[model samples]
Every structure is written in structure tokens, then in C-alpha cells.
Target: MAQATLESAAAPRESAPAPAEAKPRRSGKAATGLLTTVLALLLALFIIGPLVWLGVRAFADTWTYPHLWPDSWTTHWWQVVFGDKALGVAVQNSLFFAPLTVLVSAVICLPAAYAFARFEFPGRRFFLIGLFAANAFPKMGLFVSLAALFYALNLMNSILGILIVHVLGTIVFMTWIPSAAFAAVPRSLEEAARDAGASKLRVFFSVTLPMALPGILVAAIMSFLASFDEAQGTYLVGAPDYMTMPTQMYSLVLNYPTQVAAVFSILLAIPSVALLLAAHKHIIGGQLAEGFQIK
Candidate 1:
């Protein structure tokens, strides 16, 4: 028995089963990856192709259909846009109002954000949901309704009217985003600070505020962009005397050459693009999604 056991132990073990064939699985994954890349490229073209074409049109002197590329390039439209007085005023109004709306929104909504974050009050969910009421309805319909109200209040055609309209677009982002941020702060940190003899206010300012600041800042960026991009409401309520850059696009598209409009469009997109590029990391980091959690 011992000799037989030794022979068995010394003998070569039966070969272990070979790994299941992976080529089919690897090929399937490769095919899926290739398909995803193609789809992504196509989607990118669909979204970005027009922007590229616009850039081309802005410089193209006489390129038309059937041409794959611009025939000639010129700076005529650029010079014309730069010299236009009305366009200058529109540019000024956008730059002026967007930042102020962000500031006003922060003041009015930050406290509300804090409340929603820290307090458990009756109707909290209802109120949180209500934040979308401003933007939930069709924007044109909402603006039309505001038009009558503004007319009654003697706000029509004034800077104040435009600012108010811009502020309306900001409330959701200002409240929801910052509130999400505040809620995400770990209570333990605040408790630790409190146990160390720090007051509630002090703990909030030192710990809570610092941690949630990223969300607040992301909200601010979004608010600024929305206010800047708003057109329909601004046109309905603040037109004729107080045109913003976006509202000015109506006149550009209708009366000016396509190249001229394209140039102005590029100008209008610059700030939005710059701000988005700057805050992209925060946005991609998931704060915007966190803001939608009404609970």
C-alpha cells in the first residue's frame, strides 16, 4: 500500500484542464468596443459638425453648396461685427447682467439650500420639487405670462426687468445644487468639531461650508451660463431698449449675412465655452447629478 501511494504521488498528475477558449469572448468585446467608437464618432459629428461649418462660413468669402471647403477667406464680417454699435450694447448687457444674476441668486438661494440640506421640515419635498416650477413649464409660455406681470409692474424695457427675468432662470440651479452639496457633508465632521467645543455656526463655516463649496461653485457656473444664454424671455420682456447678446441673435439671423451671424455666434459662445472648460471637472465629478436627489 505504501509503495503504491508513493508511485501515485511521484507519478505525473493528470494534466489540468486548459482554460476555456477566450478568443470568442475577446472578439465579442473587441467588436463592441469598435462599434462604440464608431457610434461616438458619428454622434460627435452630428453635434459638432455644424459648429465647425459655422466657423468655416464665418470666414468663407463665397463658398456654397457642392463645395467641400471654403473657396476663399476674409475678415470683412469680423470687422463689421466689431464696429456695430448695437452688437456692442448687447455684448455689454450680457456681461453685466449674467454676473449680477449669479450674485443675486446666491444671496436669495444659499440660505434656502442650507435649510433644505440641514432641516427636515414639513412640505420639504414639495418645496424641493417646486424649485423646477420656474423651468418646468414651456419657457415661452412662462415668459409670456411674465410679460403681462412686468408690464403691470412698469418693468418693461428696463434693465431691472431683464435682471429679474435672468434671476428666474437661476433659482433651480442655485438652490438644488448647493443644497445637494450641503447635504453631502459628513455629519461626523460637524459633530467632531462640536465636541471640540466649536459652536454650530463655527463648525458649519469651517467644515460644512468648505466641503460643500465645490457644489456651490458648480451651481454658480451653471447659473451664470443659463442667465447668459437666455433669449426668449429676455426678448419678450426686455426687448427694443435692453437687448442681450442672445436676444441680439434674432436680429442677426434675420437681417445680417450668415457670416456675420456666425461670427457673432462665436463671440457669444466664448464665455460659455470658457466657463464650461474651467468647471468641467466639478461638473463631471457628479455634483450636478447629486442635486437632483429631492430626498
Candidate 2:
């Protein structure tokens, strides 16, 4: 009987059915998940609330504080946005300048970015740092200096002058993106193309450029939007003759109707939103850091 008792005592007690503490651990996890969800919802609301408000105000004929909803809705503001002659001209100028800036910036930045990615030489690091420095410096200072230079050259208020300023603004982003894209491309692929009797130019266009196209497209969109939304440079350089949507919107905000300004804001947001939505997959999938590994 003692042996039997000893055997019964020695046998495991079916692992004790896991302690009650396990329930608290699961509960803690559940609480953490709930908190995370709440925070995400709040963050999303914070970002989207103003945009929703702008849309509401754009349509509402009479919306003011203390009201949960607009008293009445109308398309009057949108009609004003489209029918206003000055706004039309401003939109046209912006359309012309922004795309032109992107084109010129791409032309200048592509080869420079490629060189930075593919070659190492004297002052390369210095040059790269210089690019970053140019970008980092306050736009006010740069535009102030450029204004003086443009005045001296009789380029002030000219499309060319504004284009030059926009190019300067966008070149940094353009170079950084394509450089990463080029660096990500395998050198072996280019070598193989060369070994197959392809010329350097042919290999680059066929192999390297195609691989980096997604990044290039993203860079182009950014450049376009940066130039499109430019206010300070356009104001300083293109004002009194050339006016962009942003500049016009700035004036309207201070002097014109709030509803009209809201309408302009919505119009200005459309192209950027459309482009991002269209290319979101490419933007998300493109690897910016992967190509930096030299091996």
C-alpha cells in the first residue's frame, strides 16, 4: 500500500491544467490589441478630419461653428472656382510650370544620379553632401538670392526664371530616388548584357533603366507636385505676371471667400491623390534601401 501510494504521488498531476495566470496573459494581449486599434482609429481621424471638413465647407452654402451640419449645400463655390478668370489662368500656369519642372529636373538628375550610384571618384562624397546641403538650406534664403540673380539677368517674372527655381527645388529628391533605384539593380545583370555584345548605352537603357523605372516614376510625381504646390518661389519670381494655383489660393484665403478657397484646395489635391492612388503598388513595392548593399 505504501508502494502504491508512492507510485500515485510520483505520477504527474496532468500538468495542473495550466495556471489561472494564463487567462490574464490572454486578457492583457486583448487589452493591448484594443488600445492599438483605438489609437490607429484616432490617428486616421486626425488626418482625415480636416479634409472631410474642407469638402463639407466647399459644398455648404452656409456652414459655421456650433452647427453639426451645414444649413444648406450648394455647388456655387465649385462653379466660382471654374468660372473665375484669374483662377483659370493660375491653373494653366501651374499646369505648364509643374510638368516642365519635372521634365527638366529628370533630364538633369538622371545622369547625375546614375553616376553617383555607379561610380566612385574624387569629391563624390563632397558632391553628394553638397546636394543635400542645397536641399536642406532654407528656401527663403535660396529664393532671396535667386531673386537678385534673376533681376540682374532680366529673367524675373518669366517662365524660365520660375522653371529654374522649381528645378532647383525638385532636383534633390529626383537624384536621391533614382540613385537608390540604380544602386538596387544588380551589376551582374549589366555585365551579362555587356558580355552578350550589348553596347553600354544599350545595356543601360534595356537593363538598368527599366529596373529603375518605378522609382523614376515616383520621383517624377513628387517633383511635379512640389513644383505645382510651390508658393514662395512662384510668388517671389513669377508674381506680378505669372501666378500659380497655390499663389492664387493664398490670395483668395486672405481676401476672397472661404468657400472658394476650400474649392481651390480640393482642386489642387486631386492630381496628387490620383497619382498616388494609381501608383501606390509600385511605390510600396519598390526597394529603396536594398540596392545600397554593394555585394
Best by TM-score: 1
Tens-digit lDDT track for model 2 on 1-295?
4334433453344225655555555555556656766787899899998899888889998876799789999999899889989999998998898888999999999998898899998898888888878878899998988877898999898888989888988887788888888877899999999999999999999999999988888888878889988999989998869999999887999987889999999899998899888778767775433322332
- Candidate lDDT scores, in order, read 0.88, 0.83
Residue 104 in candidate 1 has what lDDT?
Answer: 96
Task: Provide the global lDDT of candidate 2 against the true structure.
Answer: 0.83
Lowest lDDT 10-mer window, candidate 2?
A: 286-295
Off by over 4 Å in 1: 1-19
* TM-score, prediction 2: 0.89
lDDT (10s digit) by residue, model 1, range 1-295: 4334533453333222323544445455556656766787899999999999898888879886799898888999999999999999999999999999999999999999999999999999888877776468988888888878898999988888888889989899999999999999999999999999999889989999999999999999999999999999899888888899999999899999999999999999999999989989999999999998787
Return the clash pairs for model 1, or none: none
